[model samples]
Target: MIGLVLAAGAGRRLRPYTDTLPKALVPIDAETTVLDLTLANYAEVGITEVAIVVGYAAETVASRVKGFEERYGVHLELVHNDKAETWNNAYSLWCARDLLTNGVMLANGDTVHPASVQHTLLDARGDGRQIVLALDTVKKLADEEMKVIWSESAGIERITKLMDPASATGEYIGVTLIEPTAAADLTDALRVTWERDPHLYYEDGYQVLVDKGFRIDVAPIGTVDWVEIDNHDDLDRAREIVCPS
Candidate 1:
């Protein structure tokens, strides 16, 4: 399976940092970035070919493609998301549907996480689950989180940000393992989700899949220090967890 990254979001809340660069390019340390770490993590797990969906500030990421490839020793394929600035991630993800023909481990470009999270998903894929989502059962859920409600027998019953935090089982940590068998269905689901509402998140597509009787399973990442950089505060938290003082 190849690695996939959805880096099309504008991340307007990140302001100055994202003014010129995409959120994936935000510095995690002097020499590394959120995208850098994600590529490195994928490389570590033997995924050499990675496809990145780029949209807002796409030129910035484009210029760094060769540098990133040489640094990570991985081949990079850039997928253009024309609607990134106006539409949400559902369309951004669907734009890369052709590349998703093979199995893919998708990561959100805005998320800063450890390699262990990737390892967890890879290990869990052996169980034959069509879609394996990395869940953080340890994190305290809030309305902002992409919450999930699941059971061992039923798998994921629901996944959405609008769900009641008190009733959620955990937060999806922006990593998912999609088996090749489920790719076509997932792509169609995402297309439907975005067509229904251009502002819907890709997670909403996952909800559509669940509603259609997809066998989706969640793999808890155990206890890991990770952050989805949505705003300045999240950026600070990511730097603390990834770079420290």
Candidate 2:
């Protein structure tokens, strides 16, 4: 299995830094970036080959590929998303459909978390499950977070940001383990989701999978210090998590 990162979205909320680089390249510390940590996590888990889906400020990521590979001791393959600025991540993920057939530990580029999150997902990769998501059951759910619903009988029933916070089981922390068996269904769902609405998130594709009777399991990452860097406030939280003052 390989590692996959979706780093296409243009984080307009994070200007200046995102002006020259993608959100993934935003510095979590003095020298390391969000993407750097992600690659290190993959390397730690014995995944030497990684595919990154790049869009907005694609050149910036392209320029750093070699350096990142050397630093992490892993090979990096960048997949370009032509519609990153105009379309949502459902399409960004669909852009790497071919690579998904190899099985992948997928993470959102903007999220900053330790390697333990990936370890949690990798450890839970059996039981005939196709897609296993890293869920934050310990975090307080908000309307803006990508929330999920799960039952004992039926894995994850729903995943969306619009759902009522009170009804959600937990927040999906942008980490997922997708088995090779899930590639076709997930890619098809992604295509359907983006074609139906260009603005839909990839979580909508997961919803499509759920509607089609596909089982998506969840692995809880308990009380982790992680942050999805969106605005300046989130960047501060990420800095504090990785390098406290």
Candidate 3:
């Protein structure tokens, strides 16, 4: 299967650091950055076809990954999203819809996780489920993290996007495995949401799919080493969890 990395965001929360370079290219530990760690994990899972959607400072992000294209035997396809400044991640995923067909692993560029986690998720996809959203029970979910209220009886029957801090139940660890049919449904829903709210998040589209009686399997990652770097503090936390200074 192929891997799609959504790296088109401007990372406004990252401030001065992202002002000069894309968050994917920001150095973490040793010499690896967010994108480097993510690509390496994908390669380890035997996903050699990688598509990266780039936006702000695309050239620099592309340059950072050039070496890995040959080194890891991954065929890297870079798709540019010119409207990244105005659009959200839902748009970035839509941009790579063609590649996402035939089932693919989708991830955010700034998330760092173990290669084994990806393998585990893929192993769970044999039943032809429409969508599988990776989730983890976080001890303390911040207000900004995406949270979901899933039902074990019906799988991920419903997902609440950008859940309020006070109402959050569990955290959605930004990795998803989706079937082509589900991807198409999500893409269509995204179009509708975008027409009404240009800055709509990808989760908003997923919620629509849930409302349509589409079953999304919730795969709980459970107490794993994963990090989503959005700010300077997160960078430090990532270093500690992923590589450690």
lDDT top scorer: 2
- Writing each residue's lDDT as its tens digit, candidate 2 over 1-245 gives 99999999899899988887889998878898999999999999999999999999999999998899889999999999999999999999999999999999999999999999989998998889889999999888887999999987999999999999999999999999999999999999999999999999999999999999999999999989999998999999998888888
User: On a 0 to 100 scale, what is the lDDT of residue 190 in model 3?
Assistant: 75
TM-score versus the correct structure, for each prediction? 0.98, 0.99, 0.92
lDDT of 2 at 245: 83
Every candidate's lDDT: 0.92, 0.94, 0.79
Q: List model 1 lDDT by residue over 85-107, tens digit each.
A: 99999998899899787899999
Candidate 2 ranges with C-alpha deviation above 4 Å:
none
Ranking of predictions according to TM-score: 2, 1, 3
Q: List the residue pairs that clash in candidate 1.
A: none
For model 3, how many clashes? 0
Model 3 off-target regions past 4 Å? 161-169
Off by over 4 Å in 1: none
Clash number for each model: 0, 0, 0
Query: Lowest lDDT 10-mer window, candidate 2?
Result: 20-29
Residue 209 displacement in candidate 1 (angstroms): 1.0
Please, what's the RMSD in Å of model 1? 0.9
Q: How many clashes would you count in candidate 2?
A: 0
Candidate order, lDDT descending: 2, 1, 3
